[model samples]
Target: MFDIPQLDLKGKVSDAEWQTRVDLAACYRLVAMHGWDDLIYTHISARIPDSEHLLINAFGLAFDEITASNLVKIDFQGNIIDENCPFEINPAGFTIHSAIHEVRHDAMCVLHLHTNETIAVASLEQGLLPLSQYAMFALASMSYHEYEGLAVNPAEKLRLQQDLGMKNFMLLRNHGGLTVGKTIGDAFMHMYDLTRACQIQLQIQGSGQPAVLVDQEIVDGIRAQANIVHTGLTGGQKSWPAMLRKVYRTDPHFAR
Candidate 1:
């Protein structure tokens, strides 16, 4: 993957953009570290700081192989914005991300994944049950979008935006899970929580006993608290530094 010497874009772009690239790259590494990556598929995108464009992993790069300089910059319409970028963005992946970024001004980063547990939950008749605290956390801001095949059709964009509405978490029926955040860390943290929730749900469901659902009142209270907390601070600020440290310790190349 490193056959060509990747450009060092640290000083070429604005500091804000560079930092966004670093965080987004770190996010990809973190996803791979957690074993949630779907090989070279799936995508995580971050809106360029103060711009209409976004940075996404190049179409062929594995999550662990992504680097700050290797990410591609593209407009919402999938046009490559950086003339020197050496990679192509996947059209289907761009469709999913651009659909969200176009309307969700609050969503600075959008993450989507298709893990065994997440897919297991999505394929169920009732998606993402409120069976655990982790589930409750995701349910607080979650919405569901009925699967519409591969999401490549241009018409699906409007439907995706409409289904997403104002929610920060989404379950793409028969597909997988999605999360949005005001920062890359926030988005990653949401996906982590949602994935944990799905894991717990699958375990409980496998035990052959009916699940004990959380109380609706308590769920409502937690949702309210989440809104307050996220409004006060970005979702992962307190933990993101440690997360980046962990990523660097594992492999510092993502920040390159």
Candidate 2:
């Protein structure tokens, strides 16, 4: 039931664009592997290198069903850019992703997901507390955007861009979570940290025990500490290769 025709874009597009497609498709499969996908609802989008065109999954396909060649390419205005690409993108996905891409040139990939943990945390008044080491990574660069319905309104684009200004991690109030990165792996890792933070928070809350919050001093210095921990490897460059290997081991067809 998940069979999707391969467009065999290996040679049809620029080498960089093709690589972006493969990585973006890997991101989707990784999300699925982690049980983070909300069916075909949330989106993970990547910018084609040196181009305004963006890549997103076709609206009707589930995350596990996504493949490199099946992803639809579209412009800022949500117009399909791939010739005879028999697929359409989600308008809400375009609205959220395009708003961020238009303003944050550094954000080559924008990953959004509707995981229950994130939604629950975002709905709370506190919104992602400093309860765990995972939370510190997100808190170091977090932003929150109050939910405004379904995010399809063009008028909300400016507001989203403003709310997410220069922040890599975002919690959409009453909705889900979003992360931006200089590459697909960076975006995936950001979401990974955020999701874990939310998951830990909910577990503590459910336990009915007092949560030990991370010290403000440590939280404030997390960015520098993260650099030290990663040892100058920024933007998930250090971890992405391992992530790609895991995805490839699971299914190599995502690169098609």
User: Top model by lDDT, which number?
Assistant: 2
TM-score of each: 0.95, 0.97
Q: Which pairs of residues clash in candidate 2, taking residues 3 or more apart in a chain or in different chains?
A: none
> Which residue pairs in candidate 1 collide?
none
Give one digit per residue, the lDDT tens place, for model 1 in 1-256: 3584477888989999999999999999999999999989999999987899999989888998899999999998999997767789889999999999999999999999998888889888889888998888888888888888997998999989999999989988889999999889989999999999999999998999977998878877886787686676656886799999999999887888
Worst 10 residues of 2 by lDDT: 1-10
**Per-model lDDT:** 0.90, 0.94
- What is the C-alpha lDDT profile of model 2 across 1-256, one tens digit per residue? 6666667888888899899999999999999999999877999999999999999999989999888888899999999986698888899999999999999999999999999999999999999999999999999999999989998999999999999999999999999999999989999999999999999999999999887888889999999988898898874898999999999999998899
Off by over 4 Å in 2: 1-3
Judge candidate 2 at residue 110 and give its lDDT: 99
- The superposed Cα distance between candidate 2 and the true structure at residue 167, in angstroms, equals 0.4
